[model samples]
Target: MGFEELEPIFGELNVERAGEGSVPSRRFLYHVHAADPSHLRIIVTDFHSNAWEAVRSIVQLEDMRDNIGIGGSWLEFIDYVLASIKSQDAKLILEGGLDTVSGAANAKLVAQKSKGMPVISISLTELVGSAASAAITNLSLELFKAFKSIHDLYREEKELSNQLTKALAAEKERNENIQSQLEQYSKGKKLQKISSSDKADASALLNNGLENSPEKQTPRDTALTKVANRVVPVYRRARVRGVTLQDTEDIEDE
Candidate 1:
């Protein structure tokens, strides 16, 4: 692809076109410097008549200090690419064709890699022909839409998980409050039982004391008997001073 068309794809990235003599087999070599320390070099080969025929399509990574280094072989580079993708730390994407045998093999490797990350595959053959340019643009747009959908779904899942956690915590707190209330109610019932027992015991002791007393009288009964004895003598003296039955009989005889 021309620099003008590729510029929009790799915006703000440092892009350099390799000299024709640098890699004779490859038609175009695009060296792309990403924002991070790692860089990508995509090597595109001429299209063959047979789609299954092996094309010299290759991808090279530079200064990939965090990943394992590989040799110049296309297979080794594919392995390294997959390894980088699997590592989950890759910041750059180097899309290549999948029509040729080697390119198809690399696509299979990418497919076999673990998920939870995005992988975009673009065919170099489609980019060359004027008729296929529209298809390529559509494919790129679809890839972006897929990435955005995945991002939105991930955010939704995170929000649901957070809400579930909050609900569980609130349920636990409510259960704790209910448990505390139950415990307090149990303690209050126990105290009421103890108070009732104390009252019964006091009544029993008072009854026993009255039954064991010498006169079978409680303290209150004894005090009332003393008052009665003192008032009875006073009443008998007043009756005697008022009139005798013998004096009434003598008066009746006279």
Candidate 2:
């Protein structure tokens, strides 16, 4: 028993990465950060009793860099974690397993921010009390579904935006067409009014000429008939296009 306890104490416990740092190290610390914390490593000058366990507790088992077995049994791991906690006055740090790096980072960040303290690793035995796989599998499935749902909503929003662009363009064209038609109608009404007044003036002048002419005098009824004949074709065309018309009577074609 003395041999085992003194073994780690004499051999230097290598201090591997232990704090939040780069991506690779951070990943190592994620799952284990709360369980362990930190991924960087250093060679501790003293203490070999729990050196392997200390490194194992904090070192990431999962990630780009695979955790090679440091050649220690489960019992050795427990000893190392327990010793480190008692020595440092910290919680026993444990191997949190893989997929806990994010949690570790969060815990590490929070403690350092408020308390200005280093990350403390809890013991491994405290964590893996049971071996239930159901909850882990369910969580993985739910994450996949959530990602798929977000992608679908993004696609729908993009399609709706495209449809709105087309509808707005079509509406603009319709308004322009209506505006042009109104302008044309207004010009036509003004011209028609002026033309009708001119016609009345010309008829009055012709009647006065006929009343005063002493030789070969054209009759008022004959002059009016000529004017009516000329106006008939114009009236017919205007009526075809739905314009208002004035009728001339008591007139014969000359």
Q: Please give, for residues 219-252, the per-residue lDDT of candidate 1 as tens digits.
A: 8988887888775578888988898456767888
Q: What is the lDDT of residue 147 in candidate 2?
A: 64
- Overall local distance difference test of candidate 1: 0.42
**Candidate 2 ranges with C-alpha deviation above 4 Å:** 1-143, 211-254
Question: Please, what is the whole-model Cα lDDT of each candidate in the order they appear?
Answer: 0.42, 0.39
Give the least accurate 10-residue stretch of model 1, judged by summed lDDT: 8-17
TM-score, per-candidate, Cα-based: 0.38, 0.33
lDDT of 2 by residue, 78-139 (tens): 34433443342332122333433322211211111123333334222111212213323333
- Cα displacement (angstroms), candidate 1, residue 154, comes to 1.7
Point out where model 1 deviates above 4 Å: 1-127, 131-135, 217-254
